[model samples]
Target: MRCRASARVDVSEACNLLCVDETQSEHRFEEALLRSLHQGVGRKPRFFAVGAAEESFDERWLLQVLTVAQQGDMASVEFLVRSRVNKTMQRSIRFLIRGAVGRFGGRFTL
Candidate 1:
């Protein structure tokens, strides 16, 4: 299963359906760590470099990474994590992240 935007995994196919928050369903965010554990699946993460484009600051990319992780796309999240993209241009989102986002708040630039 590929997690990138229109990013397709090399696998032949993905399961028809997915279950969430169950013993059967392992969170993709967590799963990505597990996948990273193996020398094969857990290599250095790759992320798309974002320049100072006005439109590139959309939270959609971050949200998409989270959503894809929720859907068990470790590679996608890894790409983001490794790439370290930032979207703090939206001040409101920064406050929200500081207020409540991720296990803990993240880095921000003024």
Candidate 2:
């Protein structure tokens, strides 16, 4: 009986269905986040700047990584953490250099 039931299931089709479900769930979450942000203080200049930066940011990818982490995907979490750390370090270095040049009355070059 189990063999008969298993034979009726197409593995590829099942995988496709699961993928669709996951994609829909992610889409819903993204919409909800956007709605909440809009309803909140997303229109103010400060918040708008943050939102603009974040729109260019990979929030979706971060969300996926976080979800995977919650599911115990340690490797994905580690990679994401390392990537974030590197980005933060680079931004900090740039900010410090810019500040130093500004303090010395020198033009900061990228």
Candidate 3:
């Protein structure tokens, strides 16, 4: 079964923050954030990636690559590569190229 990012509210208001230093590392902030959220709560609430649930990263990427190919837009194609899609998408990319080839009957080179 496919898993999704769990739903959660921003816990920033539920407690008092003692530290707000600009020098804090991102990983440190993440650790602190998770700890604070789980602590002092009445129950153990499910936690998710801080931004994963809010971001439509995967769907946006799929649309981007496919749109680029569909329009034969070279810039969007390059943008999709720079978007940091994972290797698993390579199979989908190959499938898309094959489809384009089949659809256009070799008249267009992807």
Give Cα-based local distance difference scores for all models: 0.34, 0.34, 0.39
lDDT preference between candidates 1 and 3, better one? 3
Write the residue-wise lDDT of candidate 2 on 1-110 in tens digits.
22212222222232233322322433323222332221122221122233354543444543554455445565765565455434423332222222222322333222
Error of 2 at 26 (Å): 19
> What's the TM-score of every candidate structure?
0.27, 0.27, 0.31
Candidate 1 has its poorest 10 consecutive residues by lDDT at 10-19
- Candidate 3 global CA lDDT score: 0.39
Which wins on lDDT, candidate 2 or candidate 3? 3
Tell me which residue pairs clash in candidate 2. Answer: none
Off by over 4 Å in 2: 1-55, 87-110
Candidate 3: worst-modelled 10 consecutive residues by lDDT: 1-10
Candidate 2 at residue 14, lDDT? 28
Best by lDDT: 3
- Cα lDDT of model 3 by residue, 7-97, tens digit: 3333443122323343433333333333433322323435335456553444455445555655667566655644452343433333333
